[model samples]
Target chain A: DVKVTQSSRYLVKRTGEKVFLECVQDMDHENMFWYRQDPGLGLRLIYFSYDVKMKEKGDIPEGYSVSREKKERFSLILESASTNQTSMYLCASSPSDSSYEQYFGPGTRLTVT
Target chain B: AQSVTQLDSQVPVFEEAPVELRCNYSSSVSVYLFWYVQYPNQGLQLLLKYLSGSTLVKGINGFEAEFNKSQTSFHLRKPSVHISDTAEYFCAVTEGNSGYSTLTFGKGTMLLVSP
Candidate 1:
């Protein structure tokens, strides 16, 4: 079985604070993704990394950045958190060749006040 | 670009009753379709996927989905549902040609199963 682990299950941060959400996968998948899920808005992609240090912006990448210094770890960074940034953040990973199947980590519910 | 649309935002059903969750997608090229179920406070898990060969794909938990290319739809169905089946179901699509594995998800359909 594939295991994806997130650093935090829940988090709270004040406005204008910096936040980081970490995700690690034991499968050594080459593709990692960050998504924010909201009611009625669905899971919108924030950022994705195909390889170490290689990142690409998704549909909604504003106010968010990603780091993939190693193959097993991917991190989501909020330069300065805002109330609007509060959401259920999800991390997923898949193989480089077979992208159809993705394994997801338990999400982190971030609350910004 | 690939996009997915879940027709119904919510579906209410009783235990041992049949249920169907509709999903539609749009993409110029051949695409891979997937249905995922998210239990309360849990991450999304793959329910089923239509990759190739077969149009009807069966997944875990007695859930199944059919991919209709002509209709551009991949609707999930279950013959008899249980209270444990209550969860948020999301439909997603990824273009076959796109080198990256970026998936476009539909606004999920929340399935509420009652006794």
Candidate 2:
């Protein structure tokens, strides 16, 4: 079984604060992704990393950045958090050679005030 | 580019009744389709996937989906649902031959199963 774990299950931050959401996968998958899920919006991709130091922007990457210094870890960074950024964050990983099936981690619900 | 659309936002059903969740996609190239279920406060789980070979794909939890190329639809169905089956269902698509995969998801459909 594949295991994807996030750093926090819930977080609260004030406006203008910096926030970091971390994800780690034990399956040694080559692709990792970050997404924010909101009601009526489904899940919007924030950023994705295919390999170490390699990153790509998805449909909605504004105000967010990602780091993949190692294969097992992927971090999403909000340079300065805003109230609009409050939502559930999900981390997923998949093997590059597989059928594009992603394994998701329990989401982190972030609240910005 | 690939995109998915789930026509229904919510579906209400009673226990032991049949249900269907509709999904459609548009893409220039062939694509892979998937259906995922998310319980409250939990991440999405892969319920089924349509890759190749078979048009009718069966997945976990006694759910299944049929891939229709002409109409570009992949609709999920279950013969009889239970109260525990209440959850949100999302349909996603990605270019089939693209070496790197990035999914385009549809706004989910919420299934409310009652006793």
Candidate 3:
């Protein structure tokens, strides 16, 4: 069974604070993604990494950045947290050869106050 | 670019009743379709996926979906649902040729099963 683990299950940060959400996959998948899910807005992609040190912006990448220094770990960075950034963040990983299905980690619910 | 639309925002059903959640997608090239379930405060879990070969795909938890290319729809259905089946279901699509494999998800349909 594939296991994707997130660093934090829940987090609360003040406005203008820096936040980091980490994700690690034991499957050694080459593709990792970060998404923020909102009610009625759906799961919008924030950023994705295809390989180490390679990143691409998704539909909504503003105020967010990602790091993939290693194949097993992917991190999501909030430049400066705001109230609007408060939401559930999900991390997913898929194999490079077969990207059809992705395994997701338990999400992190971030609250910015 | 690929996009997915889940027409129904909410579907309420009784225990042991049948239920259907509609999903439509738009993409010029070949696409892969998937349905995911998210419990309260949990991450999304892959329910089913339609890659190739078969149009009717069955997934875990007795959930199934039919891929209709002509209609551009992949609707999920279950014959008998349980109270534990209550969750948010999302439909997603990815372009076959894009190589990125990033998914575009629908707004999601909330399934409320009551006794």
Against the true structure, what is each candidate's TM-score?
0.98, 0.99, 0.98
The fnat scores of all predictions, in order, read 0.63, 0.65, 0.57
Q: DockQ scores for all the models shown? A: 0.72, 0.78, 0.69
Would candidate 1 be rated incorrect, acceptable, medium or high by CAPRI criteria?
A: medium
Better of 1 and 2 by DockQ: 2
Clash totals in order: 0, 0, 0
Question: What tens-digit string does per-residue lDDT give for candidate 1 at B22-58?
Answer: 9999999899999999999999999888889889999
- Residues B5-32 of candidate 2 have per-residue lDDT tens digits of 9999999999999999999999998889
The C-alpha stretches of model 2 lying farther than 4 A from their native spots are: none
Chain B superposition TM-score per model: 0.96, 0.97, 0.97
Candidate 1 chain A, which ten residues in sequence have the lowest lDDT sum?
A93-102
Give the range of the ten consecutive residues with the poorest summed lDDT in model 3 chain B.
B94-103
Better of 2 and 3 by DockQ: 2
lDDT of 3 by residue, A35-60 (tens): 99988999999999989999999999
Off by over 4 Å in 1: none
TM-score of model 2 vs. true structure: 0.99
Sum up the clashes in candidate 3.
0
The local distance difference test score of model 2 is 0.96
CAPRI tier of model 3: medium
Expressed as tens digits, the lDDT of each residue in B1-115 for candidate 3 is 6889999999999999999999999999989999999998788899999999899999999999999999999999999999999999999998866455788999999999999
